[model samples]
Target: MEVNQNDHSYNPGDIVYVFYRNPHTQDVANVQSAAVVNNPENPGELAIFLYETYYPLTNDMAVYQSEAEAMEVYEQYFSFE
Candidate 1:
């Protein structure tokens, strides 16, 4: 199945940065390099195939369109750190 590259926030295999928090420790992390795996369910949703954490990367995670956005989102939502 051919996927529309622009349909989602991130395309499969595209190198992108994600801002997230550790589910267990609640430690916030920002600008983490990750590759978009697939959007098996939703068009704009994405799955991160690789990351530093053991937690499964889900579509609900805060994915930024750009590195600048990552910084902003991190501070806005997860700046407790």
Candidate 2:
């Protein structure tokens, strides 16, 4: 498993994009949401609550293959401002 190397940079209420792997099919879901818990006890990570509950983001859910992947999805859907 890849480990996060950067410092936690987001906070609760900040919108972020989480690229997750679907539990059933291993499909990628690049979704956006508000950060719920940034760097919980895990460090260099975050917990997000998806805007769409039909696809709830879980702690066990795989969020991005790497930081670069996450950033790519964020750039695709979210504004830098």
**lDDT per residue as tens, model 2, 1-81:** 122324333344555456554667764554434444544455555556554332333444545534576777566765546
> What is candidate 1's lDDT per residue for 1-81, written digit by digit as tens?
223333444456676667655667676454776766655555455566554333234554655556886777667876666
Lowest summed lDDT across 10 adjacent residues in model 1 is found at 1-10
Strongest candidate by TM-score = 1
lDDT of 2 at 61: 53
User: Residue-pair clashes per candidate, as listed?
Assistant: 0, 0
Residue 62 alpha-carbon offset, candidate 2, angstroms: 10
lDDT of each: 0.57, 0.49
Clashing pairs in 2: none
User: Looking at model 2, which ten-residue stretch has the lowest summed lDDT?
Assistant: 1-10
